[model samples]
Target chain A: MQYTVISLQGLSTENCQLKTEKMELKEKLIASFMAFENLVDIDLPVHDVRSEAIKEFETQGFPSKRDEAWKYTSLNSILKHDYSVFPKRDNHIDYNDIKKYFIHDIDTYKIVFIDGKYSSHLSETTHDGIDVCLMSSALTKTKYRLIIENYFNKIATKDSLTSLNTAFSQEGAYIHIPKNKLVAKPIQIVHFSTGNEAALLVQPRNLIVVDENSHVQIIERHQSLTQNPVLTNSVTEIFANKRAIVDYYKIQNDNENASLIDSTFVNQKQESFASVHTFSFGGKLTRNNLNFYQNGERIDSTMKGITIIGNKQHVDHNTLVHHIEPNCESHQDYKGIYADSSTGVFNGKVLVDKDAQKTNAFQANNNILLSDKASINTKPQLEIFADDVKCSHGCTIGQLDESAMFYMQSRGIPEKEAKALLMFAFSNNVMNSVKIPEIKQRITKIIANKLGVNIGFDL
Target chain B: MLKINNLHASVEDKAILRGINLEVKAGEVHAIMGPNGSGKSTLASVIAGKEEYEMTDGEILLENENINEMAPEERAHKGIFLSFQYPIEIPGVSVTNFMKTAINETRKAKGLPDMPANEMLKMIREKSEMLEIDRKFLSRSLNEGFSGGEKKRNEIFQMAMLEPKLAILDETDSGLDIDALRIVANGVNKLRSKDNAVIVITHYQRLLDHIVPDFVHVLFEGRIVKSGGKELAHELEEKGYDWIKEEVNA
Candidate 1:
């Protein structure tokens, strides 16, 4: 197979030298790669892949507004910060102090990271029947080298951010569910930035593989512990083999000083199912790049998200579902509530190939702008090449239903609470499909907290 | 229990309710009969303190307390309820949960604690049973995918749960069939007491046949043109609103 370098706009060879002359962050990152490599196992077989990825990132620097995919999300403002690429020392956090961040109500396998370094004291890994450990272990251990070689950095796109993450992919959660095994407890991948530096930048890479006739559920989150500036460029690649079931949930409720760029790539084999739910409640800026590729027949892919933000927060969701097989189905539903000067964007694209006959794809995005200044830009694109396929997309942007507000208020609910209830109810359709009760409750509480209402019951 | 004096309201500078005056005492059932665009619904909405209609000059007194400046929820806290003509479908909120929030919020406004779960369940069971609603209906989303009759029935069910001092039924009989009308009217009749009043706003006399009104007022061109005993509804039904228009013109 021929490999082509897809350079981001404005970062071609002609401008690369000029861009490098400024000693931008991209150049800094590339210049520091040698030191970063020396700190890790440089003799590993994955070194060549890392070298290629950094070169790719050097070729395609930080994406700018000129790029079509990055048009709605601007990095010019965030890139101005002189981020500390590496932490000076290891940071320690008491479990009791940060217990609220974890879903403690239920038992879960946790792989916790502090400032991009795996915290063995805070994590609970298992090696009984499956591999629920760190990527560093998987990379160095002889028993897991083959698996890591087969799966790591396999499905991620060649985008600048993803390549940046791949270049420094030293520590993250690595889970391998063997064939015909069922993981009883859900696995939680949490990355906490201690803000030890004035401004910190972390890239965490996660890999999950569920073999044939296996099942697994994973939850991932990125948190910042302080008010200092922190930016996280994370990538996750999931593979579901034949007849496998995988459910992934991402909770993005960091502080206003934190920004995240999450890129997730999912590949489904024959008769497999994969679903990812993203709940983005807080953050200064959040950009989600979610792509699903159906590789075999009778596969199911689902992507759902709910975003509620206020203040100057910005969130953009760019999703694509590529149907490459016959008799497969994909569903995408996203709901957003923007208030204050917040802005939201939803760009969903579904492509069905000619050979993918009888494919069913559906996409829906609905937004509610609570303030005059709050706005949303939503677009749903469908490119269908199969004549026998069923593809539909719907997009809606509007304010809360006035009549519904009156109806609730007439029932003695205050206007504030009424608005909160309506907003919650508007996103409830996406929440109803949450299979885990604890996660659902957590989401409900976050929503209630964001809405500033003491709703006693689960809406 | 309720009084409206010289009420003039408009929306976007278009007069919808002009000089509407009415009075209702406890233990009295008054029916406001009119044709479409006669402002029958606007009267109900204004009494419930809907903000869409600007009341230019009016006094809506509930038990002699001026409520014109109160919010809709404040009015509700003062024991005033208005059953919507077109009940809004609140998706994802079960009927039981919606009532729980409403009842608890009302109780909180009254400086009372949340109603106990058992007590709330009991009241829900009793009210839902009285309205002939199925047990399964209480668990579904509030009014979403509900039949027109089911929507009206759910509205009444909410009214029963609240048990307001004054309940205004706005076009409750519009989309209901005869059977649904009988059931709804029976539920209303059972809830009516000597301490609470009912103002039935309808376009026809069919609903009044089930729940007899103590008095009937014909509203024309945003004003109460005629008022009489229950016989006025029968007369309007026989003459079909045109006669009332002619009488107002003359």
Candidate 2:
């Protein structure tokens, strides 16, 4: 009887309420659709895109904690708000202004993206060792489309965030360096968001492929031109073929009001090397997932990250380094500094598969809390399925050493200066991984400014 | 230059220094001799303001100024140096950087400007030679992987660089070969002057032969029960600490 009564009530009122909500959502979606239609020349079908997203959302239940990739970070906070998807912007972004964000050491081939769309007008080509192009143009080139279709979203899953990125995947960059070629210079990929449009969502996808015996360094940086609350969902995929060397860096320095969700997947072949460094400095809520797989013998992979969270910021880093072949090695180091009610979470896993004998893996996560209310949850796990492997993982969560602090204080460093010095030194382990001078200096300055200290390292 | 009046201290709940009294004027070298657990090291650490040890009842003065309330770094600025029995191992911090920080901090506390890097490097080189410390050691991490004798030599090198008015050598001669002892003693003797004093705390009399002390005090049960000239060290070495315990009780 109760079920019959509920069914009658549901049939009478559900259609009307559902129609009203749908209308509201459609109105907001139309505004964004019109904005993008006016801004970019690309023919991205907005109606089809929204219908596909709704279908996926109905099946996936909004990507909950049950999903392995999104376990540590929750999308519930974002889905709770009825947010309008942001439209693309056609505003002009000076390439010269964006060049300042590149790592200014060694020669570099740059691919610049303005307001979620590739800008070929701001890019240049060199005769040295590599080919760089915008992803949209690469799709039209026909020769690279097979490689793009094969590897795009191959390693990344249809988790809530990546699904969202894929659903709106419109613009980004593609970099390819051929075999036996040494680029000698780093490649800088700069993405800048502009315009006063509120509630904007930008999706930037990058695919970097280094052929056999090749070497390249790529730095991907994301910056915002305004303080509005924008949502950025980005995905990057990298392939390091046999004997190839790739050093990839991702820097997220967006406005404090923005939110970011980024995922990077790397695969290495025999004798290949892949090193990834991530620096998280901005965003109200940021989540980064980095996965590196060593699928061949003697391959080496290193993943390093440093995050500074202050003023009610929330940052989460989830990383995995998998050793699937014999004689492979992996090292991971991530550190965080939290102050002013900020929160940081790090969960790293180092897995050594069976038959991967003689594998060596090490992982460490260290955090220092400067304010009493700040908190950090760090977990470094090791799963060694082989008996002959040497694997160790450890995490440390503590305040600044009182003895070390007193030691510094006794040396006449004031209390505030002493604390800042220790905090800076703590992050030095990860900052030292930067190979470029100007980029390192800029990061150092940003860190100093965030901590309210003077510039001590020369850029 | 230094005065300790009835200094009593403890670690945790156990008392170590029991009503210790000592006075050292400029140009004097005093040797504190005792067996293990006799509180010789405790007295040195107490003077240097180590926080683990609590001062129960005591008064320490430098030039008639109360220094009992000062922190270790402040004590360092006031020209008090303690060569730790066991120097700490600090990784990733170079000896040069550590010494520069120490010296600069002391100088800043004394209302002095920071020293230029070049001049500081020069001073480090000179003092390292006097202490028989290799110049390359300054580039390495502070006391990291340092041998027993190397740590002692580094301590003396730091002392020579700081040029403190009152130097407390806490078992500086404990973990050294004959050669290292001679080098360390020579370093200390070279640094001695009329405007400063040195207090050498040791368990054995072998170190006193290299840098002879002007006076010797026998510390039994945390208090100095006997005092004599430098020959007192020879007597303590010959008869051992048991004889003094018997004599004091008798």
Candidate 3:
């Protein structure tokens, strides 16, 4: 019952017991839900749904290494900070200061949030053809009530952190594409933490639905402005109807004090296609929980990621693709480069039901360690009850090829540039699949910058 | 232009090159012919500053400068090029881009700016054309899934582009067909000049028929046991290397 009793025993036995006692982050968040309910209407669906979610969080606190899903990543290091449950949102940022973080070269529909508050001046949301707007309006508006009630938390798993986000979170992006409609440009959802509090915790929720024969592309990012500690628990639900095409990208390049736990659930219907690409370059600790469920036949799911980190930073990618119908296919490829003392983990799972016959699944994870202290743990799990399914997986961990280095050097290329080129070649297959030219170009520049080289041309 | 003074080298503590003392003057093509495990490739790699090959004792002099302390790229900037037997496959980098990076890096080392794009393209066109390479081949990833003849031709194309002062071709004719062999040999012959030297290391006497050598040396057990004019290669070709091994063991 008393987690910090050992450290308290060494302190003075004072008279003020209330001041001496410290509240756990779990207890603070559970208590903050009450204040959260007071601000909104008491009789609305939000109050009851949030109350149920808080109960789930109270029952199951933050996950530990003992859990099978979190065997490699531990939340204890980030949970030790005394984060403010509610942060002030009076900070106004200059657009020029944060322009580099977005894909600014091309026009994009931006849904910008600063310190957990929606920024109207920085956002460009419209309701002319499709519903591209804020989650607050989606959750409260009468016209959006039925759509939200039907799809809002429908596909998300019952994970503890996701439940916690659903309990206390109130603001994020809500995108809905009508049937047979393709958005003119890509949409960017960016969350910036201003470091207004000593330490802050922000939970964001997003819901995206693509109707039949529609197409959509999305890019998401989280950035912290200052060095103060910040933790963000975000959840996103995506629905891809029949014959729809959806492409999603997650870019994690926050500062050292920032940590993120992102959970995304995707549902694909008959003859639909969905893909998610993650690029992780910087973070103190980042955990990605991505899941895909095939609802109908002949669906395609693809997952790809490239991670490069150093200096004690950590990143974990946990993904699952469930095949509920027959003739579905899934592909997963991830590459990581760790230097200094950084660590990484990749846990991918594929499951097929008994009736899901003739399914094909492939997974590959490759990593390079630039320093002896850097490490990675990769695992691929497959559970197939259908006898006609084909599943394959491979994992590799190695250093830069010595003979390749010597070969390049003999061709008059320096050691550093040669290494960067080899890394580019390592991740070339995944980079080739990016559809947006501007996004691909931006990612190339970021990869070059992360490698500390000035590569100005296409690979 | 190149001198190896009693060069002693080893890989993983296993002595591969023992007391190799050979001098190659400018404008001369020196053919090193030997059987398997005769240190022919080791000699080529040692001169190119391969880190895995430790030079235990002796010196490698290029144009009167000791290059034993230089790194591989440094040696390359000084105009030493090694055409590997199996060229590395660098995916996602086209042949043109690889050549541009290599040439620019060398130029940058020599206190010059990057070559203009038009001039670089022109040089690539000239070199590739001289080798009779297909224009479509230049845009593909460098050596990835390439045919053996294509790989060899690409290697020669790169050699022509760099134009090193001391060119060491290590078994460049192994994986090539006869036509590719002729084209590659012609490319090498065209790049020969009065100021640069060439060291041709091979196991078969077939490639020497095209790229004729001025001097022929027979290597056995990490040492050159016999040295002669071009007639020596013909003699070795007529009679196999068993005669050389018998002579060395005697």
Task: Provide DockQ values for all models, in the order shown.
Answer: 0.76, 0.19, 0.68
State the lDDT of candidate 2 residue by residue for A70-145, as single tens digits. Answer: 5545454443334545543566777667666666545677787666766667665443456677766555556676
The reply for model 3, stretches above 4 Å from the true place, is: A1-23, B242-250
Highest lDDT: which candidate?
A: 1
List the candidates' TM-scores in order: 0.95, 0.81, 0.94
Query: Number of the top candidate by TM-score?
Result: 1
Q: What is the TM-score of candidate 1?
A: 0.95
> lDDT of model 2 at residue B214?
95
The docking quality of candidate 2, as DockQ, is: 0.19
In model 2, how well does chain A match by TM-score? 0.84
Give the per-residue Cα lDDT of candidate 2 at B155.
86
CA error at residue B221 for candidate 1, angstroms = 2.6
Listed per model, the TM-scores of chain A against the true chain A are 0.95, 0.84, 0.94
Residue-level lDDT tens digits of model 1 in B46-107: 99989999999989899999999999999999999999999999887889989999999999
Q: Please, what are the lDDT tens digits per residue for candidate 3 over residues A150-192?
A: 8988888777899999887578999999899988789999999
List where candidate 1 sits over 4 angstroms from the true fold: A1-23, A456-459, B246-250
Return the DockQ of model 1: 0.76
Please give the range of 10 consecutive residues that has the lowest summed lDDT in model 2 chain B.
B88-97
